[model samples]
Target: MGSSCGPTGPEPGAAAERVIYLDNAATSWPKPPEVLAAVQHYLLEVGANPGRAGHFRAAEAGRLVFRARRAVADLLGLHNPMRVVFGANATWGLNQAIAGLLRDGDHAVTTTLEHNSVLRPLHRLQEEGRITLTVVRAAGDGYLDPDEVRRAVQPGRTALVAVTAASNVCGTIQPVAEIAARCRTLGVPLLVDAAQAAGAVDLDLARDGIDLLAFAGHKGLLGPTGTGGLVLADDFDAARLRPLTVGGTGSRSDSVRQPDFLPDVLESGTLNVAGLAGLAAGIDWLHGPGGGPEAVGRHELGLRRRFIDQATARVEGFQVAGNPAGPAVGVVSFTVEGLSPSDLGQGLAREFGVLGRQGLHCAPLAHETLGTFPVGTLRFGFGPFNTAGQVDLAVAALAEICRQERP
Candidate 1:
């Protein structure tokens, strides 16, 4: 493949760099400078348990948490920040949403492209005889047909429909808007797992008809690990779902039962103050006056387009996966002929210092839908810090590896 973009290395006086980070989907790298600063500041300046005390430090911590909630709410175009409940990660949020919503005899629908987070919980519920689940099949590219979802919905019995906004393995963006609209028409709640599309795509809770959205803060949101949340729509009440964990919420001290409130009801133990502080800073950096998710998304999309073009043109025996026509975020996945994805991933890291992810990417169902199960595929996810030049280098490295490893 010809290199259309120039290389992006360290500055003139800077020391040598180790590797090119391309595994943003697993967890973003090179988070904004403000994110690090915010984490440090929180740890040093205001290290206190939020909502646990009335002290200045405690109040400050509480304010930081609230600010993060508002930031997430604004990003999703949600009106109430309280509806955003912080969790350990997207999986945690998904567990809370699924486990809470589904009850005995309730019927639910989900896509075959869902990550383990959604599938595992639903499977457990099925085993326990709590709810009946229907796994809707996606196309070869992992694109779920909204009509499939509509057909799966059994008006009175189907209480909720869970779907992924984008496939983590194939980078196929689903018709979430159409699915959500169908769910709304059927009066069934729609829970969206935006772990792969949150910051890389524009999502309006109201316009998109998303009743519940689970996202990872560490991925596209550019926050530290252990930061993620579930944004509940106004019509969707958190009370319908039971708390996953309960301990100290720093509220209703006198009562033995947990407080029944938006955040307080869901947030049990002490929150990840440092991570939340960084998450707040990250949200601001992404949605500030000049900076916005759309701007960052465009940059990522350019890199994806460049990679797709280069790989399609020159990389022999390589097959790109996912819906080419549908709009994708920054994620892209492909398989090299006669080469195991794990081997290609290791070669990219060891030989070329290009860090990309391999295997099922915690979404075996997605690979199963794409017909790349067990062996999986190599995934290269773009970030705000990633440049088009990096995309060129990655493609070149893959092509070279294919040539050298030709069977």
Candidate 2:
């Protein structure tokens, strides 16, 4: 798909050029024009608290949110939109899933490649003596073996298996289908954190045997920040979970207790109407011509291949992290010898006007698994708006920085 701005030439003077954003995994930039238009439309034409009032405006707001829910459901191949619940972000959704499902003495298994969103919650649960956690170690390349996960599943006690569809740091796509198959055979619920893979790859909940899918709308979904959701299969009962939040859901107004339903049971507050409106538009764009997950993934892989070839050949002391052969989204991380990732990131931003992410990327476990802890690798995440020229520019900037630092 062509970028929002048509075929502009590269900015002049690499050091003084306009900013080139390569941090889509953190949050996408230059959102689709339709997304901005939808947000504006919601704010100007229909601004009302959704699911709260009977007026036309309020009803329109509710419809917009519902349409967003339906769009997300369709994108993920979910049958029921009610099963998809929105939250502030993926971390919030993940916390709700973990805290709601696991109980005292129940066992849960997860891979070492999980982000802090998954690890921190499970850690707290473990510390509280609520559940026993079995962390299946990944290979040195940050790829988890499905057999390892299967081995970790203790049949009767295992309640859930939490795994990321792809690592935000290393971009290693897990074998979620295989893991889900094992979970199915063992009768354990499989929850996938698809923060990095949602809009970059096709995720069929039924086909993949995924019981629960958590995704960040802002990252790969090309939506605004504070938009994220969870998809629950019909077989996964909400009754098994404790409501993370309890308050007005615009349902059961006379009752004091929260409503016992899918969305209202968990939503518990005023919805992000504008954000959802944009998100719905973004999903629509994704489903439209040349903008689905497959097309996006192929485009990104082409960029990644270019980056890998150029950086490895030109930049000395730079090594790509994780298994180069593993399937990945648009995210790529690499380490530079004798330079802190933060420093490199700063230089890239200040000198080259290239915006990229640094540090452990909220996935300390992943960095630990990749042996890139303490000093993390520099990450460049591509978005739908990024171009091949931007990738080349980023690589050239890195090579120049290395030369300057060494010579």
Candidate 3:
């Protein structure tokens, strides 16, 4: 962070293997040592269901869960940890927020730069005639206009406005804060899919006026795959929303009904306590000596810039999707002439040990917004653990792939 952090050697916790990992958008790899240790400690020492029993191990597990909930809340700028609901993944969080909040005949607004997590739920609701949906289009570069979002929200009818903080495909960080401000002015609830933006960019849910923030632990938080949740704004009323699931919360043992509380309302049954232990350690590691989000952002963006410049200059017929001249996360989608995305991605991995994702990357609408529909671009997602030298090697592999394609 103090230096350019240019990779003269392997990144922290990185392996010596030649297989380079670049698909960080789906899930980060080589998690910090602390995360792994936390998980192991939980499994070995505190193997109990949190808030389920009066046993000491269960209490300890409950404490671990609370710490993780608080850390996640603090990460998003919320003071109340109970406002955060831990679930299986960001998709679960999004589904809970969308399905639990909107009622029959209610209308919602979203953008084209959305992952299927947000899209499928809303589409299902629309198909079921439960809610009316309005999808706002983003620019070719995947930038969504806050004014366009405001125009889409029908003052009293629009119950929720769901949008991704960044594009999972091209790494375009949307003006979510601006959209939040607009939603606030219009008295509408805003749910942000922070699967991509959580650790890649700075997010202040309270400061940004975001009512509900859904994020994944595995992707940006560097936690285990089963950990993620939704955070409710401090002043937001929980009574306005309902739980998608209702069963034993371990607190409402005396009553058959779900507990009418912040976390218990949404979080039903057993949670991923082991995964949450990893998430807690991951958050601390992220903001500790390893690097905060700003440092991580700088490192990844610099790597992205390096790859883009080198690939454009050295590889013939290399083309990148989206506008490359703005503040963005590390995900970059590109194509080479005379090659399909899957072929190039496979070639890069098979021939040179470079790993990256090909195809829509679960964001077909994002690909369509960038005009890379049906067929997709090979995507490289740089992470905080990535290095400049790694990008250089990947770009060289890409150049070679293009070279073979040319002949």
**All candidates: TM-score:** 0.95, 0.95, 0.97
Sort by lDDT, best first: 3, 2, 1
Residue 12 in candidate 2, Cα distance off native in Å: 17
Task: Give the top-scoring candidate (lDDT).
Answer: 3
**CA RMSD, predictions in order:** 2.9, 2.9, 1.8
Largest TM-score belongs to which candidate? 3
lDDT of each: 0.85, 0.86, 0.88
Clashes of each: 0, 0, 0
Candidate 2 local distance difference test against the native: 0.86
Worst 10 residues of 3 by lDDT: 1-10
| Tens digit per residue, CA lDDT, model 2, 1-407 | 34432222222244323888889889987677788899999999999999898999999999999999999999888888999899988998899899999989999998889999999999999998889999998988978899999999998999989999999998888899999998999999999999999988899998889998899988878788999978898678789878788998999999998899998898989988999999998888777743588787777766777788899899878888897656888788988877778888988988898898999998887888899986889998877767787888999999887777664
lDDT of 1 by residue, 181-202 (tens): 9999999999999998988788
Clashes of 3: 0
Clashing pairs in 1: none
